[model samples]
Target: MNIVDRIWNSSLGKKYLMALTGGALFVFLIGHLVGNLQVFGPPELINGYAHFLKSKPLLLWGARLGLLACVALHIASAVTLAQLNAAARPQPYATPGAYGASKASQYMLPTGIVIASFIVYHLAHFTALLPGVNGVGDFSKLTTTLHGETVPDVYAMMVLGLQVKWVCAFYLVAQALLFMHLSHGLAAMFQSLGFRDHVWWPRIECFAKAASIALLIGYSIIPVAICLKLVGSDYVERKKYDLKAANPQPAPAFVAAQGKEAK
Candidate 1:
């Protein structure tokens, strides 16, 4: 067989590429989620986390570049695989094929595509990189800081954004898709890397499901809390100082390292 055939035809080769690139993106998403969750604690906490990241310009940029690369690689491989799979089977099934599986298992690809669109819209709105503000999800707002920094209040934007029923609904749905994707993807990543065996498959799959559910719930709390008006922008101003005091270093290298090691 030719080199091109060898590269694409081999299951191990495809799985290897998917596993490594997917795992990298997964780790980044978990970290991003955790950082975003800081908005729940205090404005200062989230800003301080942002401040900490900004403090290391090089590392921050490096991470962004790395993430972009990983995402590009992951998306390219996924598209190629999907196309190949579609081409490999020309005849469409007469009816829906019966395969008993959980919701997470059944809709991985469709859900992932939806979530990917959500991510793009989300980044455009919140990150201020995208051209228009309509996609801002919910939190775009004008506000003043205690130190008199005139800035858009991200926490407020989140609160206000979620207050809109449609935005909240979209966010909740996207997160649900994320949860379902992770439910199976996590275990599949490990299995692809040869960490799986028949004895461990059941246990690993259970753990993945549980972890996915927990993360989904944790992230879902913010929108619900905001919708209820249980928490809002004032929470950040009240709690920023304490957060600033807690981790004055602003680099969080130790924390990031610990988290990676734990995983």
Candidate 2:
């Protein structure tokens, strides 16, 4: 067998793959949160940013495809390793001890599955612009002016989509699950990759918890802001002004008639 195939079939190789993919995803979450936080800025700022991304279709779709591949590899390796472990231990534990596994560790699989499912729904709601699912009507038609140019009103879409109480609630719940999954996954990833020295273990664990909490807070801000009415209705009104500013109407007919008579 080739070296690649041999490594992939080994237990250590599966753990390494999971660690690498999870680390990549963790970084992506941080970057994505920072970008989403721009919604708190002026309509132009976020809309312009969205326009910039759309202008680069190659980079955008490349990143999307890469992320999808990483997700598939991560999930496949996880499932394969899990099945292998289960098959190796066909008998139940006599003492019922969890073998020092934390609650977060024990529930990683289910939480990961929930987060995966949430990702699909999220893409459909925002990226795909699904009607009724995102609670926003004709999101593609929503436009805002940025530096005299009309662009997709991403800020308005975020506000309208999360303003629905149920959607906000669902996001909050999914974030909580994501936190639970990350809290364990981050530390476990390091250990799996052979960074489990006793001297640094506690520090790594602390960092994992801190990172997980940061992610939770960052992701929760949008929904919380919408729920408090801090972003929804007001943004919609602002968007109307932006659209008007981008495409000004002609002068009134009375003014035009007076000018014609004067000439």
Candidate 3:
């Protein structure tokens, strides 16, 4: 068998895959949090940032594709490892078990599945610029200027999307699940990599939990701020202007036909 197939078929290889992909995803979370935090800044800041990224189609898509692959592999490895452990673990002791393990660690698979579903909803809500789901003006029409160049107004999209109570609720739920998943996964990575020497393991776990909490707060604040009217107070006027500019009334069909006949 090929080396790739052999490695994939091995338990040790699956552990390594989980660890490495978890690490990649952890880094991505940090970067993503930083980007999301930019919403607290001026619209130009986040809008320009989004515009600059979109300007590089190749690099943008390359990173997205790579991240998608990592996500797939990480989920696959996690499920496979979970099944292996379950099948090998001959029906625990007769006494009460779990011994106070956190629910985050205990329910990794379910939480991961929910978080995965959230990712799709997130992509559609924000990245794909889908309308109706946002409960506001069409996201595709939400344009703003970046150095006089028109670009998708990410700032407006985020504010409007979160202003919807139900949408914000979903985001909060997703963030909670994401926090639990990250907390457990980070600690698991260290344990799987043989770092459970008892001396530094607790400290490592503490750091993981702290990191996850920080991410949770970072992501949670945006929706909360919008909901409170502290942010996006100008949403009404901004949406009207952007939608008008983006979707102006169509020219009269008879006038257009006459113009074409003249031509």
lDDT of each: 0.70, 0.83, 0.83
Q: Which ten residues in a row have the lowest lDDT in candidate 1?
A: 134-143
lDDT of 3 by residue, 69-107 (tens): 999999998888898989997878889678889989888
| TM-score against native, each model | 0.76, 0.86, 0.86
What TM-score would you give candidate 1 relative to the actual structure?
A: 0.76
In Å, residue 67's CA in model 3 sits off its true spot by 0.5
Candidate 2, residues 1-263: lDDT per residue as tens digits? 99889879899988899999999999999988988989888877777888988999999999899899999999999899889978998888888778788889998888988899999889988998765476535455466677787677898888877887888998999999999999999999999999989899999999999999999999998899977888657768665554345334433344346435754
Question: Using alpha carbons, what is the TM-score of model 2?
Answer: 0.86
Q: Which pairs in model 1 have colliding backbones? A: 43-236, 44-240, 138-161, 139-157, 139-158
**Per-residue error at 203 for model 2, in Å?**
1.3
Candidate 1, 110-190: lDDT as tens digits: 987998888777776566533234333222223436355544455655655566667678889998888888988888888
Off by over 4 Å in 1: 1-11, 101-103, 129-131, 135-152, 233-263
Instruction: Per model, state how many residue pairs clash.
Output: 5, 0, 0
